[model samples]
Target: MSLHPRRTGWRFQWVTILWLTAVWVLLWGDVSWGNVVNGALLGVLVTTGLRMTPVDFHGRVHPAALAVLLGRFALDLVRASFEVSLVALRPRYTPRGAVICVQLRSHSDLYLTLTAELVSLVPGSIIVEAHRLTGRLYVHVLDVETSGGIEKARQNVLDQEARVLRALGSDAELAEAGLSRSRRAREVAAR
Candidate 1:
């Protein structure tokens, strides 16, 4: 099934309305007629604010995939927290800080942003820059135990990308293209 859809202004309006109402209910915890009107107005203002900001391509995504991706991210965050904490507590540790380049397969800006944000939130790594033209991410890591440290970090990013691609229902070509590009970039950098 084709997930992509042509979104209209009305759709955006409805989305904004629904989102605002939900937020209001959550915040106030009591829904009354007054709250309903206020929430709707707030939604409109929020939508207007959003409209003023320019965003890149907004693509339709598979719901199942998105759910899976979110779940995986949650799990990864928990695991990363533990790992980072352990690394931090070790007083006699020699941290090998290195900037690793990660190649992303999916061209979606949302996916890229999500990946970057998620990785950066983790303790040991931070995404310093993302090259739009190359779809490559430069990540600064807190620890590196040799030259392979960069490669390991790159692999972690690639793994996250793979999960995102799967969630988006991307084909093998797209996945392979991203991995190939990343590998090639790393090879060139190494040489």
Candidate 2:
């Protein structure tokens, strides 16, 4: 079955709508009902007005892993914020910047995009470019020291991808990425 079926009447895509609405709310930096309603309206308008590519997805949600992903994300946000602030405040230190390409384990565009977005949200790093076919993301780090090291930075992106896949990928999808339904598997995949 297709991820989204072709409908003749309403042609509504609920997943796309929710994704777009979430983006809209995040962009607005608010979680109010007004923002939600407006975002949903805009989401509907965009989906109806333009053509969208169908994303392939047949995965079950892992609530425990999903919760871990979100909780780690919040902690990372705060930590990155503080570290970036320190770098900015230090007048004697010169930041070493580098653009590194990270090859992701998952070939799916969905995981690649999710990892890129999540990585970009944290301070000191931005996604420079993403190759859809290659599953590689070119990321610019404001300071190598601030973000540990080049290798660590690359691992960080991969770890983020692992978190995303563990949260939303099915057993088959996980196995495809060399991940299994075990703590050891998650640990190994994150590295």
Candidate 3:
């Protein structure tokens, strides 16, 4: 009987255990009862021994809004990729990078962090720091002018936060972010 030991991750995650078992079985080249059971035991030991705090998610998902958020993220990714490439290809052009601080409208730290992560995924900008107490994020832009200057970059981060709120925010959460659910979204979710 052999088991694949897994590292500690988030708290009491069932998916982690299942994934560890699957990886163990895959590595062994044959699925057997010993491997499965042993793998689960190892997963349990690791997860229980070292636990991380779980994210607090208090919102019902709006499917349409979620789709919109994902679609926009993809588009932004592609657009940013090209922009970064163009800047790199220009030999004579000197890019000015700047760190811009943005205050998030969302009251929840979850959305604030999520917004930061999403913006970082796009090219030309990365999250430098997130201040949860003040609900602010400091992002470093690769090229300020390429990203349409400081104020525009700041607006982009705020827009990203709005997208996050629209996707997974409750009514109260939306209001707290200074955003209102679209009439269409409200109608669709009502059903």
Candidate 4:
């Protein structure tokens, strides 16, 4: 009857706890002291029971890359909200929705999970399913009327992965994700 979880080289699951707490806070729509305390407690309890086999991560965090990803996410969120609103409100307009399957460049389970969650968090798209073995994401996207639109959506996912890799992926992981350091620098410069 061990009280603590078996060691996984990591002392604490702060990331899981914090992410769960944030979700709890957002779902409750309140950030009061009481709510926060309850959320944190719930986060701890939930994370304790839902332990996963930790995978090796050789990633390094880059503050600039994180900032850029956040900025881009914010802008995309706003734009997508407007687009969805328009599609819903307009009478004559029909959004071309499709289930797009995108093969991820990063085969790591962590990267795939992060990319899927982040993409689904934004409006106008949702990850309907994910194939772990194939590293493919089946996302239902709005306004995907043409083949070009589908390709654009796929590219968007790839770009999102690239941005994430730039922020927190190791050198090997970045290369696996098909984003070279020079390409990353070029992307930043283009922005």
Considering every candidate listed, which one attains the maximal TM-score?
A: 2
Please identify which of the two predictions, 2 or 3, would achieve the higher TM-score against the true structure.
2
| lDDT by residue (tens digit), candidate 2, 1-191 | 44543542243377778999999999999999999999999988887777666666668789999999999999999999999999999989999999999999899988888999999999999999999999999999999988889999999998899899999998888899887766986688789
Q: Once model 3 is optimally superposed onto the true structure by TM-score, how far is the C-alpha of residue 60 displaced, in angstroms?
A: 2.0
Query: What value does the lDDT take at residue 81 in candidate 3?
Result: 100
Residues 1-191 of candidate 1: C-alpha lDDT, one tens digit per residue: 22222333566568758988888977998888888889988887776655343334334465776787789788877876877777778899877688878878766666688778878886678999988677888999877753246777788888777666555534453445443224465587579
Query: What's the candidate order when arranged by decreasing TM-score?
Result: 2, 3, 4, 1
Q: Which residue pairs in candidate 4 have backbone atoms (N, alpha carbon, C) closer than 3 angstroms, thus clashing?
A: none
> Which prediction has more favorable lDDT, 1 or 2?
2
Question: What would the per-residue lDDT of candidate 3 be over residues 1-191, giving only the tens digit for each residue?
Answer: 11222332344268777888888888888889999998888877766776545555679789998999999999999999999999999999999999999999986878988898999999999999999999999999999988999999999999899989989999898877667789677577679
User: lDDT values of the candidates?
Assistant: 0.70, 0.89, 0.86, 0.81
Q: What TM-score would candidate 2 get against the native?
A: 0.79
Better of 2 and 3 by lDDT: 2
TM-score, per-candidate, Cα-based: 0.68, 0.79, 0.76, 0.75
Better of 1 and 3 by lDDT: 3
Q: Candidates sorted by lDDT, descending order? A: 2, 3, 4, 1
Residue 53 CA displacement from its true place in model 4, Å: 2.3
Misplaced by over 4 Å in model 2 are 2-45, 184-191
Task: Kindly report which residue pairs in candidate 1 clash with one another.
Answer: 96-144
